[model samples]
Target: MVTTQERVGAEPDFALNPSGQFGVYVHVPFCASRCGYCDFNTYTPGELGGATPAGWLEALRSELALASQRLPGPTVDTVFVGGGTPSMLGGDGLAEVLDAVRSEFTLAPDAEVTTEANPESTSPGFFTRLRTAGYTRVSLGMQSVAPTVLRLLDRVHSPGRALDAAREAQDAGFEHVNLDLIYGSPGESDDDLHRSVDAAIGAGVDHLSAYALVVEDGTALARRVRRGEVAAPDEDVLARRYELLDTWLADAGFTWYEVSNWSKPGGECRHNLGYWNGGQWWGAGPGAHGFVGATRWWNVKHPNTYAALAEKRELPIADFEVLAPRDRHVEDVLLQIRLRSGLPTSLLDADEQARAESAVAAGLLVHDGHNLVLTDRGRLLADGVVRDLLAD
Candidate 1:
């Protein structure tokens, strides 16, 4: 449990939290256009129709202030602004949010601030403004560099524009840039995937997050697939693609830091790392989720409702639950197993450890000192392996 003293700093003057850590995630739910495969909570401004008229910024600030009041502690170590397309916020709006964050929390001097951007929404001047506004890292969504694949995914920007955005991000003096790509799209060939990878490497970013497409039930992609409009890639094909991606990225001097993330030396995303490591963070904005100690909560999904509730000086929490110790333990095991660090022996019982040992002996895991990590083949069946190891 977080003590009251820990929640609020003791001294009248600025005092850092003794815990020395906390992360902040700001969600920007505005998107110019939603992708076919995306089911994230988002809305186009055109749909707003002046109901709130850019009031989200103020509402978000108010919400942040509320969060500060509830969990007033030291400066945050990392801040990540992710979204439908955070670049849609233009430079000025982005600056306003960042300013609010600075006032609400003690931000570390070298805190890593990352913002997600879509190639179509990004400009060189905009990137420069973001840098001046204190964003140290930029993640660009360049899902695919092939025209056919882009069309299949309904990406707003052309392949050329995506590459240009990457170059512009570098030119804007961002020390760390991440390019996001998606594999296993319908009708995507191995050649197409390779070209996308080659293009990303050519664009010269510090990190890459390549994800396989999953068809969520209510998504447009899933509906289309059901209607025979697009064909989903088979498991065998996806496995081959994953293998190629792992091999190629390793050859390109990138480390597989997580299942879907690869980064150059010293370039891992600290905010995401905090999640995997079970660190505490505050999540603000519509549909944003936060984990503080054992309690997990999420904000309301509707923008107008969220703003309205915040205006009344109340948290827009739609639902929340305090996890039991056993639940927390299970989650810790599950999250850790997905990372390269693997799980500590102390996290599992003797019976579970015996099962893990058998898997290790079968070459699915490698024992590294006190931790057990997945081998390449194990990564392919990570879900099943984790379930087996965590089973009671």
Candidate 2:
């Protein structure tokens, strides 16, 4: 079995190794407005109106150049441009950033380049331009189709607009289009969740990411929930909602590849799959995180600071930690269990294997020869299951 100790011991500096499969993540920290539940490092013009995207783009280009020099010789298999709202950066800005990537790295001919965008920000012409710029995939944030739920989430776009955006993307010749939906919000009913799912399927999305709303600490949602201004759904309700999503999407011919992701045949997000499989990826821009094998690093959170560091021709890495062998193994097992691929028996030690057997007997996991995967009930309590399996 491939224990965490063995993997970590063999590759102490996996991040520095040049011959590993590498992915790229570019963060665009600008958003027209922040969602109440969002805590990602995103800035709005109101927050940083004085700063121009031109300077930030140059800084990002410089950072990519420096990263290319430092980490030489890995073919980039996927590129994900995630953001406060990547679409906010008009076509020209995206083109410039993509151009820099091509010049600095070896991108696979069929590399899946995806960008996260809000439906309200997309322009039909702009999406076509993005396609010409080499972006093959687009993930639109269509949190909910219900107007009340949209207001609760502070989303600016309506259901019709979101649908229009998806249609526009398809018309623009995007090979793959994904829709992100959030469920279990305060006052969100089963009907509301079903409506969103129906909308996603009706839109003919290649991929769907349906996440349950979690009251993250420090977010407005959390504050509201704590103050009783908003009520959090019970675990039972959330579980029922998730099960409904699975059954409905599966019936619609979408496969549940990951716990929260469903896709049509051959439509899974390759970049995300790389992450779950413990592959290497380089993250650029403010507050972006990267995992190069066992070593994980993140850039500075402040946009200006990150830009200044890159402007000085330095890697903007603010903090980093090299994972211990056990940590890496635990991560692998945890991530693998969340997918249909399942965790290999080799990844567990004797103790972990025993625990897995117990979990399978308890109906939390299914053991298929060399692989162990979470069952539906197990997925609902995934965090608890991971903790139990990883217990020393």
Q: Give the TM-score of each candidate.
A: 0.94, 0.94
lDDT value for model 1: 0.84
True lDDT of residue 27, candidate 1: 91
RMSD of 2: 4.5
Question: How many angstroms is residue 319 displaced in model 1 relative to the true structure, after the best TM-score fit?
Answer: 0.8
lDDT by residue (34-121, candidate 1, tens digit) is: 7888999888767654534278888998988877877756579999999878888887778777898998998999999999988888
Prediction RMSDs, each to the true structure: 4.8, 4.5
Per-residue lDDT, model 1, residue 149, is 86
TM-score of model number 1 = 0.94
TM-score for predicted model 2 compared with the true structure: 0.94
| Candidate 2 segments whose C-alpha is farther than 4 A from its true place | 1-20
- Scored against the true structure, residue 313 in model 1 reaches a CA lDDT of 79
- lDDT, residue 367, model 1: 92
